[model samples]
Target: MTRQQAIVADLLHACAHPAVAGAALFALSADAIERARVGAARRRQSIGAFVAHSVADFARVASERDKALLARRMRGAPAPIVAGLEAILENPPRA
Candidate 1:
């Protein structure tokens, strides 16, 4: 696991107990997080995962509903290296 992934895993207790917590939390850019939070509040919705949600939102724009669903389900919960999540969210996503 990468540093960020390891950190998140430790926070989620995945490192201490794999069976209980198989998920790994990834780090999202501050801008993306803020944008997601603000946008959600503006739209009267909750921000799920800015980076992952951005991907899914695009999938929806492309009319890939299934992909959007899956993507939204996956936001911030899993990734090969949690740090890479910053790349995904650096551009940020709006709600």
Candidate 2:
């Protein structure tokens, strides 16, 4: 896993309840995570993985939640990445 992803994983695992530690784990709100999960599920992928790719790419995300989702996805990426995450949803990553 990438450095960022590993860090996130640490945070997630550290959580008293990983499932409930969305904000600290990913820097996103709970609702934002839900939206990201839904988006990923639509494409048949893991919410975590989808977030990893999106954040790694630094795409033009919409809300703070998107950013948070990206952080969460980074955790345990490639293992269960979020699915159906659309690149076109926001601006492309910076050069």
Give the alpha carbon lDDT tens digit for every residue of 1-95 in model 2.
76665554444343323243332326554565766677568867666554554454443333546545656554455533221122212333444
Best by TM-score: 1
For all candidates in order, the CA lDDT equals: 0.40, 0.45
What is the C-alpha lDDT profile of model 1 across 1-95, one tens digit per residue?
Answer: 55543543333232223222113222544664565567557766545433335444432343344334334434565553343333333433233
- Candidate 2 clashes: the total is 12
Off by over 4 Å in 1: 1-26, 49-54, 63-95
Error of 2 at 25 (Å): 4.9
With a 3 Å backbone cut-off (N, CA, C), the pairs that clash in candidate 1 are: none
TM-score of each: 0.35, 0.34
lDDT of 1: 0.40
Cα TM-score of candidate 2: 0.34
